[model samples]
Target: MYDVVIIGAGPHALSLLSRMLINTPDKYEERPDNKSLFFKNKSGVYKTKVKDNPQTRNTPRQLSTYLRKGGVIDENVLNNICVIDRHGGWMTQWSKQFDALGISHLRSTSSIHPDAFDLHTLVQFAEDHRREGELLEIDGGIRGSKFTGPFIVPSLGLFWDFCKSVVKRHKLEDFVTKGFVTRLLPKDGGYDVCLASGDVIVAKQVVVATGNIGVKRIPGWARDVYDGCVDGSLLHTWDIINNSDATGIHTSDVCKQMVKLNMRNPINNTGNTVVIVGGGLSSAHLVVKAAMSGADQIHLVCRSSIKVRQFDLELEWIGRSRFIKLADFYSMKSFEKRSHVVRSSRGGGSITPYVHQQLVKLQESGRLIIHEDTEVWECNKDENHWSIQLSNGHMVDCYIIWLATGSIVDVTMNPLFCDVIKELPINIIDDLPVLTDDLEWGCGSGLYVMGALGGLVLGPDALNLAGARGGASRIAHRLKC
Candidate 1:
């Protein structure tokens, strides 16, 4: 049995472990001048505001009960903690995912990191390593200066290396096991984390950071329509690039295979036109990647006009605009209001303006073609290529159809969560669980949640690094370490 079973090896899980291992000062509080952006929890905990509802299993005051007598783990809890992941190599899955997505840098600022003690731990690490020149200063207004500032975006290399450093410092890899958690059975004092490999782990407290976006979002049309086409070059952005088929094949051999296939079938050749469906940053990045990878025609089919901003959310949303508006939003009786606020703040997947600018350049140079406010009306695999029908009734034939649509957030998709909902009273809002201020799944339950599923308490940034830090702070504060 373990003291705490931190699930997933993502930034949130790493953040929680960092906080638990090291006693860090909650230094550099949110700026209060922008009342809209700053939200102080008052003292060390939130006040008990219980709503007298007979049907609800947990009253608001229940959170205060957990806070009053929160969790406790010795500094050596790292040894007692059991971390589970299918990949087994801490955050190698994330590294693979980011690389597969063709992303170069993080969308979040440098201030956000897994280090518990210092917000600028990453920046310090960069400078200490004498690689300060690699970090780029953000040009947008209200930039954060030097340490503990979002004014800088860490290169993917810096961010990845920092995470590895945290793992090495804590020796967390030794405690992590490789397996998929298929079921979470809550017992009297803890939970039985069952894996796909049939091993079960018992823990005093279980933190669910498995993330909501496990699978890629594939439209029904694509899968249903292309059921029997071996020549079809359809793929998701998350698909393993170096699949088992391409494992032993050298790059030259793989090219020869494609050449042979192209000679046998002209329609399967993706050396020219490639249609990328979706309007998110993933789609934008992939569009550019396709062009660079030698696809001369990069056709972007967007269902709606692209929403391009410098970051995920606008600057105003980061500050008073979000806090002030969300305060009024959270006070409402229903969870729908808070849900709407979270969704509307960063509604659709958006590309940064820098990407938008690049796409424009690509378009002007005739390397990229864009179809805004359009989607696949209907089409099937033809003899030559996949014939496409746009929502605007345009006809086109393409060699590749790439779907960069983001993942789905359905709770039912996760068997572990589905089992939890069956046994416990899980309040669902817009398909996400209504977590408490402590980020716990329910009242008095040892199971705490982080990542996108913690949207109820994390406001709008539940899925990003900011949300990861916020969730970790709450969990850390409620600890008796």
Candidate 2:
């Protein structure tokens, strides 16, 4: 039994653990008369002091000490929180998949680091017992509950070392990690977590930090056309990423197919030749990367023309500059004219002129082409290739396809908590859990969610590095209460 059982050992879960331990009270101190000390800000957005209680007021100090001692949250918090079909180690999997497909560089700059949460702190805690590249796999789940004391703290590796230090310093070791939880229920009380190996855990409080595990795939219409094709003709980007075994295809193969299709079906190609769908930084990067990769013929297909506000100005300026030479720019307005719409949750944004100038150079060399204001009606498979039909009655024969589609929050697919999520009344935002303002789930007290799953209300930043930090702070405050 555990006091708090967190599903998924991703970044979000680790951050939450750090916050929770920081809030637990020390044992040597006398019981403070103030309950307000337990309640901090709703979210960890603001810092507050325990007006009448000095013990609780030292929460920040506790956190600082933990950090200095090299404490980190658990790793199991992000189970299966990865791109659907990529391979490699963790974050590097997607990059490797792109490389396997002959993609030289990513569209966006790499910003994630192995020790993103402060390596110095992590190193300090590891007295050389464990270093990078060490794999620690724990096989078990919470089974019941027990009350160790008022202080409930869980530990893992260096994080545990720091917790032990804090406990010894505060004389609070009676609160062991093995049996600190009080009660465990199926839904509201806690989550009934069952691992793939048949181990089970009943936790009093559950925090689901699983990112995009239960969400559905790209819309059915999109999947139908992409997956239905034979000869590797029409396919989603995910299929390409996931199907690492598929061979004899290169990124150039995809580009060449698009060009041939346009030349064969000039009417469709001329009006809406290439439709690149998506509106994220990934999309913008793809536009530039494609142009740089010698793809002269292409079109951007999207749902809306409204660019991400923050990136719009930069992209627009890039378009007006040399980058426009790479490919023709089109938006939802252009596609609407063709009576077709590509479904994507992300909105279109602008690109840099530097990238566009490269496109222009490619076009001058007869290597780049552009089609704006085009809509795809349907995609089907012919003998060995794909036959793509546009709304304008023009058909394109291509050997490859790329679906730069986006992702969603999905909990149903996670093996650890699939049953737990199904039994809860948790609200769903685009198929993600709806969290309270304090980051706790409304369905169960002490249960919370973070990361991309919180995107509906938290905005687009929910999956980025900044979002992780914000989530950590928020969860920390909740534990304080």
Best model number under lDDT: 1
Q: Could you tell me which 10 consecutive residues in candidate 2 have the lowest summed lDDT?
A: 80-89
- State residue 243's C-alpha deviation in candidate 2, in Å: 3.1
Query: What tens digits encode model 1's per-residue C-alpha lDDT throughout 19-137?
Result: 77665345332222223234446452222221211122223344233223323434465666778877786776677666755677787777677766556566767776776775777
TM-score for candidate 2: 0.52
Give candidate 2's error at residue 217 in angstroms.
Answer: 4.9
Clashing residue pairs, candidate 1?
36-320, 37-319, 37-320
Residues 314-363, candidate 2, lDDT per residue (tens digit)?
A: 22211122112111111112322211111122234443333344445655
* TM of each candidate vs. truth: 0.83, 0.52
Off by over 4 Å in 1: 27-75, 141-150, 226-232, 240-271, 319-333, 479-481
Native RMSD of candidate 2 (Å): 15.5
The positional error of residue 254 in candidate 1, measured at the CA in angstroms, is 11
Candidate 2 Cα misplacement greater than 4 A, ranges: 2-6, 9-189, 214-222, 230-232, 246-276, 284-300, 303-365, 392-394, 409-422, 426-432, 477-481
